[model samples]
Target: MADQRVAIVTGGSGGIGRASAERLGADGFAVVVHYAGNRDRAVAAAGAVTGAGGRAVVAGGDVADETAMAAVFDLADSEFGGVDVLVHTAGIMPLAPVVDLDLDTFDRVQRTNVRGTFVVDQLAARRLRPGGAIVNFSTSVTRLQMPGYAAYAASKGAVESLTLILARELRGRDITVNAVAPGPTATPLFLDGKSQQLIDQIASANPLGRLGTPTDIAETVAFLAGPGRWVNGQVLYVNGGAA
Candidate 1:
């Protein structure tokens, strides 16, 4: 099993994270599914991976907590030999205009999105094996400049910066560091409270005329992790022309 590739997917308990974990599992990588608070969903994701004939285990941690995330990475190394890919799909989105957004909300978003990416990517930079890849999450709102997304967009902007700099810093290491900025993905996290009219409007904003599915984002992650070796230090916008 030393030749097997291993992935640590943060936020693997829900939505796009779940899809990415399952897809990577299908791609012949042993996955360590990391969740923040939901053990049941993490178990379910691990089960799906195992059912698909891939190796997987569930781990729980806050992405911004160094100790907790370090434990998750350790689990991957001990369980599957070493880490090869890291898909950081864990983040939070709270929609409020910049002027109206509370300081607490801004702080929370920055802690989870900016600080979380920093914590996780630092570990990946130190731990990923040769030829490994790191895929960090961003948001199309960064480009779309949509309303009520300033805090979220600003946080993702920092993620993009980290991703670009890390790829350059890892020269000669045969690793790729990139960010995927998805737009209007149709997950519970994106759709839970929106009115049907607003949802329809946003869905139609994309040229595809529909909200993006989790699998759509996962396909892009899989490419960066597995076959898309030449792509690095770039932000691939997976927004279906929404931007």
Candidate 2:
């Protein structure tokens, strides 16, 4: 129906991105599942939305490519009437200490995380209906200051800044902008290089004593996207008090 809300979830192929997409779908938003290179994974995400009787479709492109991402937003408008929410979760994490991190890798991470966010946020800022929301992804590493996370942390730091500034820039537009900074979550992005011992150490450091699941983060995204009307220009630390 024309009045049904639509959400475009970037990085919907896996992890927290997919979980947020699923949760929003369950909440009755028509979803545009956007992926960069994983069509099969994205297809399954869309299928989960459909399988559970929610409306969904898949759109694929490089999130940093303005033209490509513009097309993704266009597809959402064509398919779902208009966009009401944007969950920008497409990003990369390349771990290395500041001294050892390759400049090229750092550039790539920023290109995807920072620039991709700019491209998508620009589009959403232009097209999202009033009363919409934009949720950007960040990492608690920005606060944790963990070693081997210099490049990744820097990128997310940019995300947090952009989210806050944009929220203020959209004054009177009725669109809420916020970033979700998650602590050591068990997604592939967080667990890829850590040993079980290291993982356990990080988990135990949290007062809650465990790694965050995607659902934990998704619930926050859902709240900000839907009923959390007053939560504007904020960075929600969705960790279990690790930071």
Candidate 3:
């Protein structure tokens, strides 16, 4: 096993997850890129880490499944000694007003966003090495109170609450638990099906006058995971002043 610290980033195939994984690798953590279904992208992310003079491996599992999550932990133990950091960023956003939101979509979103976070964090609480950190993903929409985001916002609200409580619960372990609430980021998922006019309008809504980038959020994650250890049990909003 590598003597370097190890970090496992779920949804590491793209967007904020990928960016955070890369940043953590560059920060000297041996990263494990976890993906649900994108093998190629996961491999690419691992390659990026290795190319940057860090150790990395690709692992796949459903974040919401206990058995799968157990396997993921096992992989980390066998491959990198043990997990020193855990970042839960795997989530699905199916935007719809509460009145029109499909039951299936709502359930899936809750499963991935809420339950997945709980499962992964439960494992982390039990297994993370002392001084390790757990970073959960939330949304600026939870504070922005935007339309068509009731379900998504509600899910992230749970994550925010969980992070705070988990921090206290793990107080003896010296593990810091925190959440990053990102605003309108320019990810593929966010850009899909949006016109330039709509995108520009959204950009103007932020004080920064542009949508957030994955790197923007990733930098915050890196901080909370690294030298920002004192920032426990808080939701650091990286929305360019949108909230």
Candidate 4:
């Protein structure tokens, strides 16, 4: 295992995070599955990796908490040597019109989406070995401009800004920083509370005429993590032709 690359995948308990964990594991990275609250799911994510002949471990904490996240990174260092990839897929999306959204809800969204990205990316920047890659999550809704997604879009917009600027800042480190803005993926997070009509509309918006799967997004991330070294600082819209 001395020659294996290591990846710390936040939100490994759910959705794109789980897919990403398994994909990176299959790609030969010893994965550290980071979860905010669900320990069981996190364990399952790690188990899938090890069950398939890859090494994995589970770490738990809010991604926005610096001290807690530092411990999570320390676990990766202790268990797998050093971090070579960071897939920050942990985030929350609550839809409400900006004029009607509660301040508390807006603040909570910012804390998890914006602040979490900041804290985790900061740690990744400091700890990742040379040639490491950092992939953060953004959304196509930011482009779709769906009416109720104002707060969510604003938070993700911050993430996109962070991705671009950080890539420039890491100019000579041989590390690639990029964001994956997936469109209308068929995940619990995307399917929850949406009407069938809405889902169909979203699927139709993409030229592919179907929804993207976690694996679809995961493959894009896996490329960025491993062999897609020349692709840096850009947000790849994995939305099947959705703008």
Q: Estimate each model's TM-score.
A: 0.99, 0.98, 0.98, 0.98
How large is the C-alpha RMSD of every model relative to the true structure? Answer: 0.7, 0.7, 1.0, 0.9
The sequence of per-residue lDDT tens digits that candidate 1 reaches over residues 1-243 is 899999999999989999999999999999999999999999999999999999999999889999999999999988999899999999999998888999999999999999999999999999999999999999888998988889999999999999999999999999999999999998988998899999999998778899999999999999999999999999999989988
In TM-score terms, candidate 4 sits at 0.98
Runs in model 4 with CA error above 4 Å?
none
Report the Cα lDDT for residue 47, model 4.
Answer: 97
lDDT of 4 by residue, 36-149 (tens): 989999999999999999999999999999999999999998998989999999999998887899999999999999999999999999999999999999998889888999
Ranking of models by lDDT: 4, 1, 2, 3
In candidate 2 the C-alpha lDDT for residue 142 amounts to 89
User: lDDT of each model, Cα atoms only?
Assistant: 0.95, 0.94, 0.92, 0.95
Model 4 worst lDDT window (10 residues): 200-209
What digit string (tens of lDDT, one per residue) describes model 2 on residues 73-131? 89998998999999999999988788898999999999999999999999999999999
Worst 10 residues of 3 by lDDT: 1-10
Model 2 lDDT, full chain set: 0.94
